[model samples]
Target: MFSDNREQLSRSSTFKLLLYFLACIGMIYTVFVHQVYLSSDTFHRKQLDRELSQETEIFTALAGIGNIDAIRTLIAEKQSIASPFTYHIQPISTQTASLSYPAALTGDQPYFELSDLKSGSSLLLDDDTILRIEINRDLLQKYREDLAPMMISGVALPVIVMIAGAVWFAVNIIQKLQRVNFAMNRVLCGEKNVKLAVSRNDDEFDILSIHLNFMIEQIEKKEASLKALTVGVAHDLRTPMARMKLRIESLLALTSNNQQQQELEACHDDLELLLGMFNGLLEIANLNSGKQLISKQRVDLTTVAQDAVDFLQPLAEEKQQQLILRQDAAHQLDGEPSLLFRAVINLIENAIKYTPEEGRIVVVIDAFGIVVIDNGEGISDLDKLQVCEPMYRADKSRSQSGSGLGLSLVDAVMKRHGGELVLRDNSPGLRARLYFN
Candidate 1:
């Protein structure tokens, strides 16, 4: 779950925005620290350098005046008072060094070793005596010690607050987007009434929700208008088609001319096909409009599959195909028995219509759903995406005799049952599954 959440966050624009903000903050903080350290270091180093120069001049003047005793006494006084300075005196005639320097400063070091926490200067007087003065960088150390906490709080506190705020903002934006996504998914699933929740703040997200709600409303209105028009046209044509079918049947009963009878029978069959298409359109429209309430009961899916197979077995056998059912146990779920049976029948019929002679068709029943697999010229990848639409016939199935509402009606039935019809490519065939929730 954590990994999934992390992945989602990584893909989120809000999270990316936060990362960019943090990068900028980090850059600013680095530059700020560098500048602060440079300014503080330069100030303290210059101050220490000036003090060292002054101390060296004082001792040099004493050596020039030949007051060596005064210089020695002053050095002794400084050592006794625990001053930060250390002194070293060397005479060229004696070729020996005075051991007055601190243990940490006993080397013949350069004038400035700032990194060693010490700075020094030396002068050669007229008496050929060398004087060196070194001072501990205690002031710089103190400044660093005092500035550490300030720098930490200065950068850390703001960073922490910004991170917290950014996290909250990202979460808020993601939640709003998720709600919108969920609503759109419901709409896609045929629930046109679903609407996004609008918050009272009227922020951008809320505005987006409002606009989406308006769009859904418009879509619902247009769909209702279209469905009404379709239903109306079908109803108007249905009566005339029924009359035509009856007339053709009457002519068949009256006239015994073989050719005329065959033509009339063909006309009757065409009329029946037209009537069936109209009825299917009306059924789908009623199902989609929620005007038809499904009466649900605990129905055994295996029995429904058995019924469909038994009904369609003769048709499959006529095509020299095998109709097989594989069910280990009875899987019972709450659904409309008639609708479930119709959906299964439609799927099996489509399989029989498309599969070649000597092909195999299997109906598998499980706890979750029913699957109908057929070894036929399967639907193309492109056609599978739109084959379920009303009156949409794939190129492969175009020459076949169908109004092209079989899959659409099955889809409607599944929706009415709160299930789904999923079509898959079974390698060399088609696999259709009816998944029930």
Candidate 2:
């Protein structure tokens, strides 16, 4: 069986355009060479005709002087020069003027002999003498040989210059594209305000930079507006919710029936949950808005990981799960200790909540980051992307009792410290990795 061996070619516009330009130059060179050949052929034919005419004038004048042998001698001398013409002289053989002519003039030779002039020229001399001259075909070959230097100078050199110019233009465009790509990548890597540098020339790349800067500006504006709206809404709602919680507690104190007391207690619990959700929203908003400043210092990740494990050990034991710490080396990173601690706590808590009873949770600290893993039902592939989004929880963890904003807050803290929180499968479990840079 034969295989389909198709592959994608380069999609760069600069490369494609350069290829097209070279093809055009090739076609133009073909046409130019054809025209040059035609011109050179005409020029050579004209030179041959002039040479024949000069020889004829000299032979006629010499014959007019009534010295036939002298004319023959002159023809022999002219033949010594490097010329395509060959001359022949024949004596009169008949008394009749026409009868004494060469066989070519007597209609004994084919018309092509005269038409192509390959059989030489024939001149009628005094005393019924005939003189014949023929042009050598090698002269045509010589014309072609002489054309090489002319074509190189007139055509090939210019084409080479044109191709070089096209290559330089393509390289310039590619460099501009590379700069644009670098700027976009920097923006993607958490530099929200970064934009392409614009020049005053207003060329295509400059125009592109202007557009990109405008787009980033609009995005930053919209993001700020959304954060402001979220914080405002959470703050406005929390006041009334707090008053409602106080009223419910007061009601619980005044209630006589045990049923009413239970209802008041449930109401208070609901209020507390709502208040906690609002607080989480506010915390994330402040972090995003750059209002939650971090006090960064050199902190050992091993200590942080160990402390988080120790703090959550009691909860892990209550569920009959193993909380273990594995440190390879003492790794230090510039970060806010309180924020990093909170992130570690969230990871460990999430691991404990998802892992089955008596499951093993491992906190591993390495040279670059900390990884909290558990031998539990890991998150599905579909939920991994949305895990950091606020209020996003895996289906298996939906039944557990906790706010879904734990990982979301942890993600915010990591970003605030210029780090990343990665969630992935640990083959048989989930691995939550925090990379500090």
Candidate 3:
């Protein structure tokens, strides 16, 4: 099955951008929550200290002129109120009436110690009376209860919005890219006029579509120009070449000199070679330009392989070589018979040309594809890739009699049939595979 997940995460800029956005949002949430928590802590601590300072001054004033009893009475009256701070007098009374006390308290500065407030100061009277005030317990829990929901909402709302936006953006971009890929595939499959629809927004995808459409147009123009030029040159040369051959033959008949006849024969052979080259070029151009009409029907590839083997058997016999066909399976495909025949012929001919005398050649028809193998010196790794290009021949095959257009023509034919021609090492020789899609 075709999958887009790997492509989206690894290749899509939109997906990567959304991931970065989410990362940044998370970082901001963490920093904002930390700072806000600290600010709330400082504000509550300052308020507590201010209240403690005010209460200390009031008690000292009430205990003026050595009136310890009055100070005690004043403390007893204030303890009746429900306040965050709970005050107590030790060595004087068991306890004051208060709902609860701060669980931890230390120092006269009224600092928090594990949810409790502890502070104490001595009152100077005629005798001695020390008043100790300690605040403790549940302060931290109460603060957290108030701050938790507010802090959570502050971060959660934006995070939710960002996540939704990221999903929406990634989906939209993927859909647009899929459409573009579909259009490009059509073009690659030989639809020269196919073009993607450019969006009005002029986004990155739109720009890419514009460039791709332009590239396709350039390719079409170049191919059309090349085909026209090849056709014109081939047409222009055919008649002159024909007339020259006829004239040379006529001259040979009239001349009685043996040397003159030999020269004329050489000229005739050269003219025939030139004609053959032109014909090959014209055929390649026609196949690549899609000018030749192809009537695709059910073609039995095993039969094709057998026919090619039969035709090349005489040539192989002349050189004392073996040419065999092994049909493991009979496969049928939709293609033009003549073109497919030409492709198989080119492969068999190439093998025959390269293979030495008494060499073995086999044409195998299997479920995978059609493969032509020869027990000869295999093509070099460097030459294998360039062998399908027009006029490209390996250095080892330089002296061989060929137009060097045979493999190029076969490559063109395979592509027209929605297939590929792959060249690989055949252990001791070369293996040419024609794969159908």
TM-score of each: 0.78, 0.77, 0.73
Query: Best candidate, TM-score-wise?
Result: 1
The TM-score measured for candidate 1 stands at 0.78
Model 1, stretches more than 4 Å misplaced?
A: 13-25, 28-32, 57-70, 80-82, 93-119, 123-130, 137-172, 254-263, 288-290, 293-307, 332-338, 380-386, 415-419
> Could you say which candidate leads in lDDT?
1
Better of 1 and 2 by TM-score: 1
Clashes of each: 0, 3, 13
Residue lDDT tens for model 1, 1-437: 66866677778988898979887987798689768877877787777777777777777667555566888899899889876677777664553354222223223331211112246765543334556667765745776788777777877787888877877777777777888998999998677588788779988888899999999999999988987898999999999999999989899999989999999999998889889999999999888778888889998998899999989989998999999999855688888999889999999999999899999999999776999999998999888878898989985536888888999989999988888889999988999999888
User: By summed lDDT, which 10 consecutive residues of candidate 1 come out lowest?
Assistant: 108-117
Q: Tens digits of per-residue lDDT for model 2 on 254-373?
A: 989999899899999999999999999898878876888888899998888888888999999999999999987678988889888989999999999889999999999887699998
Better of 1 and 2 by lDDT: 1
lDDT of 1 at 201: 91
